[model samples]
Target chain A: MGSTATAKIVALPMVDKHADPEPVETKASAAQMSAAEIQVPEPEPIPTVSLTKVFLGLLGYVTRERMITALLACISIGALFLFWYLGTKYRLEFYIRFKNVPTPYEVYQQLTQVGLSNKYLFNIAMSVRRILLGFMIATIIGVPLGLAIGKYERVRDFFMPVVEIMRPIPAIAWVPMSIMLWPNNEASIVFITFIGAFFPILLNTIHGVHSLDGVLVRAARCLGASEIRLFMNVILPGSLPHIFTGLAVGMGVAWVSLIAAEMISGQFGVGYFTWEAYSLVDYPAIVLGMITIGVLGLACSGIIRMVGVLLMPWLAFAPGGRR
Target chain B: MSMTMTEAETHKGFIDVRDMGVTFGANDNKVVAVDNVSLNVQPGEFVSLIGPSGCGKSTLLSIVAGFVKPTRGEALLDGKAITKPGSDRGVVFQQYSLFPWLSVRKNVEFGLKMAGVEQSKRNTTARALLDLAGLLSFENHYPDQLSGGMKQRIGIVRALATSPQVLLMDEPFGALDTQTRVVMQEILTNIWQQFRISVLFITHDIEESIFLSDRIYVMTARPGRIKAVIKVPLPRPRTAEMTDTPEFMNLVQELKGLIREESLAAMAPEIKDRGLSGFGMKVGPKGVGEIF
Candidate 1:
């Protein structure tokens, strides 16, 4: 048991890329050094926590507890596959139709055939680029505007109404107006994507600022922080965790907007490919395009999560991290 | 006002509140949190405000800290009106108010950094202060990683890093367990003795007030007014053994009596309004057994 524990400690996972290495090493040595001094008749080796590696962390910082969570995630996805296989094989048509839908193997066949094609690859690249560009622009404009709206009462009064009135309107509803407003299809689609991502980021940021602890501001002021210094030191850091939440939610919305714009007016994008396949009666191809979209959407959100982890190093090993 | 007090002779942390009152809302909804009250803290003196829960002890402290404006009069620090919060007065709150994002060392260094101190200087100052608090080893840890007592200790150390003239504390140990609170009281007195900075503390604990303060101000409940001003005659570098002495116990009984009177008065209006002032009324299904 002792040897296994030592090996486990030796293979400890990293919490963050910038996690300080000194404590982890010292704790490890301390635990090992204490082994020879005590000979109590305990059933198991008493846990000596190496704080850096033993607790939960983000991305590549997988501990044994997180591994079980990962395993459960895999099982959930596997269940979905099992349902899909059964549905296609039995031609189930309980409420929704799956009578003529292709099996998972058939979809895989379609993926191998056209997935490597220039058109498919090109469409995937276009959709990803559009979403990323739109998201970057949205974040740049939304975060500061949100911060301003959150900080000053007058700014909130002016902007919050416009945001509130426009927020509930679907991005797809703006597609026609966006097309007329911009010079080209790319600009129009990007605009629609921006509209999709912007409001959540703005609203979340406002809420974040509004919810900031008043006592913290008092504490900061009493500590001699000037107005600018208070904003930089307290206000900015306090709202960052919320901003990232906004970013992740924005990324998801941006994808939905991207697909709508691409399906309606795009020359090339995964959304266009999926819609075109439907028009051409290529069932398997449509499924394959959808799968591509799902994979890419997951990838986009995963990247946002990792960035959130990177920015909030304090939250890296915390269980809930942030709300 | 004394004629002989020179500008240099008047040291830092000399607080003066003259007829200060703070009222919230107005007209029909008007609530007077603090009434016309006057008090002063001598430079380097340890003072405490003790009262019932709603007696505006915290409001008085907040006025001194420059967080709340006085509706009637003024609060002065070292002979100047406190127009706004400044580094000259540091505050420690009851909530253990350290930024969770910062490491313990960084939390301590926050005030110094705000004052434009260099990184190396911040480090050394923070380290020295953390050592003084007996938390030098835990400097690298975050606030969330520390226990309640540790967080409050860091809060004290952080407040002192700027070399502030006065420390304004509002029941800082109110949330801690009894054991931790006693230990913290000792730790705080030690820090106070070391720096000799003036402290204006607020607490509901009578013993805490008597134990820590050179002078104690007892206040009445809502629209709070100063009820009494008492001096603690305990010698310097006070020990736990001092608490058991007849003098200390006598002070405790005195403070408790003062506070109990105000607490009963605080409840009287509400009881009258609710029409539950008399014991003749039936309560809880008309039987004591049913209530129990």
Candidate 2:
């Protein structure tokens, strides 16, 4: 045991790159010289790290991650085909109806027709543009207000009751009021979409700001951060993850509400096209529209998640480490 | 021991505490954490406050770092009362307090940035301190990517960045395993010698206190008071080998004995007797024997 311990101590200097040789030698010899004459070694100089190494490591990790995601994608595609085949072969009314439900090939034909048209594509683009513009406008208005509500109890109390009454009223419920209020139908859709997003983002921002760790705030204060610096450096950054959560939820709501808002107004959009297809009994085109909405919603949420990854890398290492 | 107080007084005390105490809660429910403890620290002195949990060693250290204000008494540095924390006093918390959001280099640069030190100077100082802590290779790595020991190393470098006049460490290596703890001690000793800054180290580990401090102050539990101050006569830049020395062992034993006594004293029941419990047995009495 004694010999092993000594060997272990001796082995340490080899692995501990931080251990210096000269003073260790002096300490080793000084024990023989006198009891009081011993001195520990100076610390070894730390080694340098190259940025290229970090970049390579990150690249390797990302490649592995992408490979796993690709495998999952293949598995999902297989599952979808199996479900479709089983539904068609069984001829259960649920399955038979699904089979009669335009086949992927039939849907593809209709989608290609609609998707290829510059006018149709332009209408889809306009709907997307309105949703995004309204969402952006809501974020600009809501985030700061949410922060104020979150940080100050008086602000929360002052606005909370009014917000609560407004919150329960659906975005579509606002279409009549918005149409009456705004000068144009375009503005009304934008207004309804903005209302759809504004509450979730605002409420989330308030919660985010309110939920910030008091210890972290105190830590910043102790580090000599002024009030403005503390808000910018600690509060803003800390609350961002919550803000993003709000944005993602809000965008989903905005996308869903935009179709309603567009239908109420009956303009040239994906919603308008779907209503027109239904009037003409063009069921495949209707299905195509629904699929398009679902895909766009998925894409928008994915963008929010990707933005989260870019903006707050720390969120990736949180205890759950899940999106 | 030769006095450095004269030299220290020329610039005023590095840190001065007068009848410092902290109380939490309110009214009848109030609990005192620290009570009427005063200590003067000079520039370049390594002082360790050793005590058990709830003894308020950390509270005392926090007060000195200006993270907390004492209900009574004032914490002064260079004769100036500390109203709030500044770059002049840097703290290393026990649980590896590196900012998880930042890279090792950025964590170290945080203090420099707060102080408004130019980017070039911040880079130079951050690099030097990381090298000193043996974490230079981990400069760009985030805290989560590093091991516990490596994280603590970055924590030390972060605290050291502003060249703080006093370094306050609250059980800085308390979570590390034994072997890593020893290596960290050696690293801290090396850094202390090179920097020559005053340190207020809080620890419950008696042996760790013996290893790193110029003087160790033992504190009693709950509403802490300084029990005794033991001067560590061991020479500077203490090595792991010194831990096996007769003198070092003797000091460790002494601290352990004192700690054992303090623990028993703190745990002793407020009542001298348990009334009728002692009536049956005559070996002594039911409440006679103490923990020590």
Best by lDDT: 1
> Of the candidates shown, which would achieve the greatest DockQ relative to the real structure?
2
Residue range A1-323, candidate 2, lDDT tens digits: 24333443564554343433222332332222122212222343332254467668888988999999999999998898677656655644842376456566667888777778897797789888898889999999999899878878999999999999999998989988998999988888999999999999999998898888765666566566787777777777878989999999999999878999877685877787778788888878887888778888899899998998898887666657652
Report backbone clashes per prediction.
Answer: 0, 0
Clashes of 1: 0
Interface RMSD of 2: 9.1
Q: Tens digit of lDDT per residue, candidate 1, span A1-323?
A: 35533542343223211222333332332233223223221222223555434543433454666889899999999999999999999999999878878899999999889879998999999999999899999999999899899999999899888888999999999999998999999999999999999988988888788888888889999999998998889887889888989999999999999998999988799999999999999999989989999999999999999988877888753446652
Largest TM-score belongs to which candidate?
1
Off by over 4 Å in 2: A1-72, A75-100, A145-170, A206-215, A313-323, B1-13, B265-292
Q: Can you tell me the DockQ of model 2?
A: 0.25
lDDT of 2 by residue, B236-277 (tens): 656667889999999999999989877756654532344223
DockQ, all models: 0.23, 0.25
Q: After superposition, how far is residue B64 of candidate 2 from its true place, in Å?
A: 2.0
